[model samples]
Target: MAKTFASTGDTAEKTITFAEIGEGLYAFTAEGDPNTGVIVGDDSVMVIDAQATPVMARKVIERVRTVTDKPIRYVVLSHYHAVRVLGASAYGADEILASEATRSLIVERGKEDWESELGRFPRLFQAAESVPGLTWPTMTFPTRMTVWLGKRRVDLIHLGRGHTAGDTVAWVPDSRVMFSGDLVEYHSACYCGDAHFADWPKTLDTLAAYNPRALVPGRGDALDSPKMVADGIALTRDFLTTLYDSVSESAARGLTLKQAFDRSREVMDPKFSKFAIYEHCQPFNVARAYDEARGLDHPRIWTAERDREMWEALQG
Candidate 1:
């Protein structure tokens, strides 16, 4: 298999792959691109995180058609990222769902996020021209909600914020399977443009409580077995912890952003260099961590221009 990531000039945007992680849950991952998940139950199918556009989502729908003919009843937005939720139209579900906070973020900065993400990673969008607009959830919940896949019992919850303010998960209680958005990753890079470093670990703890037997991560290969699932959760937490600590230490020492970025890489590289998206994720990771170290609660919006500016500053 190809490595999870590579920097092949601007043309390299990573590749997408559909993998079956559990009996009925699937992980659709790209080589460091945004990831999506699917849950098939007795009555209907629920897709987590529509790709960037209807054309792109059709690709996923094609994959779904191979296995089942059940109608897609729900499209779940794990968060409000442009690359993740914009393709919801293709599902044509009556009720799209998300955390109430996610709905608020969509109302607040959804357009900006669309522009920002579209600018940053164009390849993942597949059919950029086909994007209808920012996707909005029809139904919103405060924290947790449960849906029976005709009695399969999939729980959707916003336990805590890790990747974004409205991150959600699709968990099967009986099967002990979970589709963690960007909250947990196996090897693919974790995007942190709007991450909450301090609060993410506690949220992770809540996820770990279940000790899932299988997990389809936000990106990377599917993890099977309780050991692999636990490993995924632990590695993700470690990444957040290490990134935050290094950036916090740099701020405490009063380093400049560029200086802090370098410091963060120096601190995290030896152990994480082989991990997916290490290079690509480092710059944005440092920016968010630096803000949090200074006591910023929620992450600020990331503009396309800002992404380029920051990438140039750190990557140079």
Candidate 2:
């Protein structure tokens, strides 16, 4: 469908970089691919988001070993997306954590999402068979939960909905560093396939109030300074607002889905065409924005079958 969903051709290997943004805090970024945040405490370590497969996660583990030999006690699922959580088993952490909404999403659509994402982006899942099965969170929380690794404290908060209903961020009060899931993206297209477009900005505001000295985004380079952190948040906000405004206006003018897509593309391409996953995400983002602008508060679940249906309808 739509030629492997737009990004299957992107098989070029990305250069991986692991930067220590704060004391014992690292951001493992592979160009524009999904990023993994590492928080090492005095005695133990914590990982923010797992990669797509256990094989892929080993790369992060290899990097982790380079710095500290502390045992990884926790793996935090930023959200319920298969691309982010499926590699959890590789960590062998004592506990896996996620929001209650995330857990419910896993129960509801985890398998379908696994097939859907694996098909859409083959490059991310290096070894598909290596994924044992759907990753499940052993521990779940509602709004906010705090965990301590010796003296270091990590606060996991479900700020609000943005990338998905279960969006959660890890806040390290001591370092003022935030591990924002897909709630924010920097110089990359926000995959709005399951996004709450209207509610995203408000959540961004809540994130900004923290005034994080550094931010580890779900994708793109990690922001090491306060100004870069603010810039990242601003860029994410602009992308969402522009996408919704373009599609909402077209919808108001009685445009069909295709017509709305065309209008949205004309407005977004010039500014965001170079962003990571812009091509892969535009159609889905426009479709969701169109739906949300029409008063749909909750995003519709996306399955492998539905993904093909939407892609063929818009891209065919």
Question: TM-score of each candidate?
Answer: 0.93, 0.98
Clashing pairs in 2: none
The positional error of residue 23 in candidate 2, measured at the CA in angstroms, is 0.4
Q: What tens digits encode model 2's per-residue C-alpha lDDT throughout 1-316?
A: 3456758889999999999999999999988899999999989999999999999999999999999999999999999998898899999999999999999989988988898898888999999899999998889999999999999999999999889999999999999999998888999999998899878999999999999999999999999999999999999999999999999999899899999998998999999999999999988888888998788887787777887788888888
Q: After superposition, how far is residue 143 of candidate 1 from its true place, in Å?
A: 0.2
Candidate 1 lDDT over residue span 30-99, tens digit each: 6666677888999999999898899989988998888889999999998888878999999998789999
Residue 243 of candidate 1: its Cα lDDT? Answer: 83
TM-score, predicted candidate 1 vs. hidden true structure: 0.93
Clashes of 2: 0
Clashes per prediction?
0, 0
Please give the lDDT score at residue 161 for candidate 1. Answer: 84
